[model samples]
Target: MNIPKQRIKISLAMVMPALVSLSILMTMSIMFYIQYKNEKRSLYNNTMSLNLSSAQKMAVTIEALFSGMRQSLRASANNPAIEASAASDQKELQVIFDLMLQSSPYFNSVFWADQAGTIRVVSPVGNNLNQDRLKTEGTTEALQERKSYISAPYRTPAGRWIVLASEPIFDSSGKYHGMIGGTIYLEENNILHRIFGSGAGNGKESYSYIVDSGGRLLYHLDKSRVGENVSSNVVVKRLMGGESGMQRVMNTHGDDYLAGYASVTMNGWGIVMQTSVSSILADVDRNLEEQLRSMLFPIVLMLVIAAYTAARIAAPFTRLYKLTKSVAAGQTVSSEEFRPHWNREADQLNHIMRAAAESLAKQTLSLQQEAVTDPLTGLSNRRELERCLDSWEALRDPYAVLMLDIDHFKSVNDTYGHQTGDQVLKLVAAVMSDDVPKGAVCSRFGGEEFVILLRKHSMDEAYRLAERIRNAILISKTPYLLPLTVSIGVSLYPEHGRSREDVFQAADMALYRAKNEGRNRTIAGVKSA
Candidate 1:
């Protein structure tokens, strides 16, 4: 009953295209039907992913900006020069304020006010800020709390919408001295606008905005909306309530939008990323009827075309889906994963995701560095030193700890001003940094004080190194012509004392005795066995 082989092959080939083409057409029809039914929901999910990513990115960056401002203020308040120079001695305070502004880009203005809330010194002056009294939320809260604070948004008497980050300055003997405040203008080209502004204005009806706890707009794509109150908006209300999510909602203007929102952890502010529903759904506007009209070729040809078309549409959606998953899971995706997919919508999605991830990575790195680095001296900060101590302690390693204090440092501040005194700190920091071996830490412990940890070094080796550091400081020259000296106290871990704190305490006691004995000498602490 079998037909001849050649005839059978030809018959089967002819029947195959008809069957495949029919199946392809049926599949296309079903896909189009499903798309028509769920297209809005599907598209909304995709756009919401993008919106959420942007909101999270903006919030992280703003939080970092706020953290940097706080760090700068804390460093300023800790400076002894700041404590020494008060009222009518703006020379020293002015110098420190200028340094604060120069070191950090987060502040639009830096100012210092005394205990009575009088703004005494302002850097880059004449910005129309009130120089007489501190009336802003940041200063008021800092003065009340007697600690560092970042205020919510408020309006200055000069009518500037701003957030003030202020730190309470304490004098050397532990009395409340004053506060240092830095202001960030909301409506201007501040860091907020510079960071999240690029998220919108693409003519795609996609935009980003920020709001404080009060639902007052801090940043908006529509310039007019900046500084306006939008608390009544559903998104703002949810954000103020500490809820983060995405939903489709109608704006006050009666336009529908898919919005994603999150709160900034450092400040009680909310960021929103949204896009118009009409614009996104437009991509699905090419009806199945129109697609069917274009598919009237021979069966074989139709099958070929259908395969090509399905691959074209399906590949990009797959990529976008995978990208969304990665971002949601907080997994960093490679740039190579975002190669141009020959589709406009997919490429744009790829670009958005990549840019956000890259920017977030950079900001995270910067924050990590800032958290462990002394801004002025560029040495390991106290936080970093403590972290290192924890690591060494866990490893149960022995090391030498040197406590150094600049002799006559206050006199330097008094004679030449804080600017020159700052030069002295930097000079001392540099001299200590120049000769430290690998696996050692040089950190600024506090004002005019530094700590160096030398791993695997005996007390003798540490004393010699400490002496070199002390001599280097004695020979170093400050910006102003003044003699310099440093007293060093060296202690060996486990030998000097059992615990890290005990070793540090022994070093401090030795340092105290050195200062008592003379102004400039190195003392190796002894522990009774």
Candidate 2:
């Protein structure tokens, strides 16, 4: 019986190009790494500068808005028809209130309240807290002080949070009768949107928010947080102190951000704009990618030239060595091949070629290893994951995609510091490696996220595996006595999705769903029988 020999061969020329390429690659990577880091630092500085400018722009816009609001309130207050008409004269006041609403579309409501804080006529009705004294922040001051005032954020009896801009109503004789108040509803009427709706940040991850002097959020891109206190926020704290500038801060939710803040002059309210640090670094990665693409032609050209030149130089020697020689990844050329052949020039050439071949072979393996493995986690990297997925897809093999994220992992970093956070990541990686069977590809899928591709797994099997990992992590001890939990999303191949992108996306959506559904459990995506 005849057995077929392996077709692929590793030769002297084949090894030389990789050797040259590896050396060049090392030099370029180091230089590029330095440049990459510098670029990141530069990007951060630029983002902060832009954020500060955006915050200032929004603050100035709001100030101008208040100036206009004040003018409208003053005009309404001093108007003969409205000012002289008794607060009890609802018919006369209604005409003027309707006119004020048209001119000040930015205001949510308009009202006439007498000196006793009893609201008389309210425009945009249903907001009638008429029977009660004016308890909202700024209205009472304007009535008692007999001066124009802008209130801090306060909740209306209608349960709406707003800023009340009010002017005292006094006749030409300077006798105070009542106050005119215009309401800027925090969440509705698009007033905040009209001022900050264009948004200060570049993308969805970036947003602008407003906080009162007391730290209550008057406006935020997330309406749910509008009334929540953000005084503990670094940017908000600075804004409260009348300090305006840009800085890198970690928010209350343990996310790092580049933020800029300014206090609105009218009421000492702080306006802040912020973007995520990770988002800015993504830009840096794109720059690096562009840089790599530009370098690609030169790299390929060098490899081609090196391979041709090395082959041309070794032509005669190759004829002699071709039949008897081959070098596998870990195997080396016998030292006997390096012994003196007794012809000085021929001996030296042969010796050097053999040694060079061995060196390059080792280097080729080293570069391949480094390319596919994650340095920190020692697991397969993203490139490897993609490569394996492609191979499996081509073969029409079954697999399960599990995306796992460490819950509140940011808090681990914030509380114990980044070094400790790194330790937690490693430990989690270790747990994943130990729990998941061998040959399953587990990767640190950026930040606190991990991805596992389980070969030949059904949807149920994949979910069970995810639960095992989650339970192990929850019960596992941390480097600093911190308890950790994981959210896992499982999706199966061919059933959930036939393509790589589709499958990963299914798993990712499930992963986020698990997180959204309050974490520490597995959610199966795209279920199939």
Give lDDT for model 2.
0.80
Candidate 2 per-residue C-alpha lDDT over 420-489 given as tens digits, one digit per residue, 9 for 90 to 100: 9888889899999999987899887898899999999888788888999999999999988867899998
Error of 1 at 233 (Å): 1.4
Estimate, for each residue in 1-529, the C-alpha lDDT of model 1 and write its tens digit: 9986664343323333343455456556766787776976788898988888878877888788777778878888787776567644778777877887888788888888878888778886787766777776657776788787777787777777888888888776788877888888787877776766666546448777888988998887666667788888899999999778888878767789999888986678998888998887676666545555576555457567544544556544555555656755767777677777667655655675576567656867899899999999999999999999899889999989999999988988898889988988999988888988888999999999999998889877898898888887777766876668889888988898898889999999899989999969999887936
Q: CA lDDT of each candidate?
A: 0.79, 0.80
Clashing pairs in 2: none
Q: Residue 510 in model 1: shift from native, Å? A: 92
- Which 10 consecutive residues of model 1 have the lowest summed lDDT? 8-17
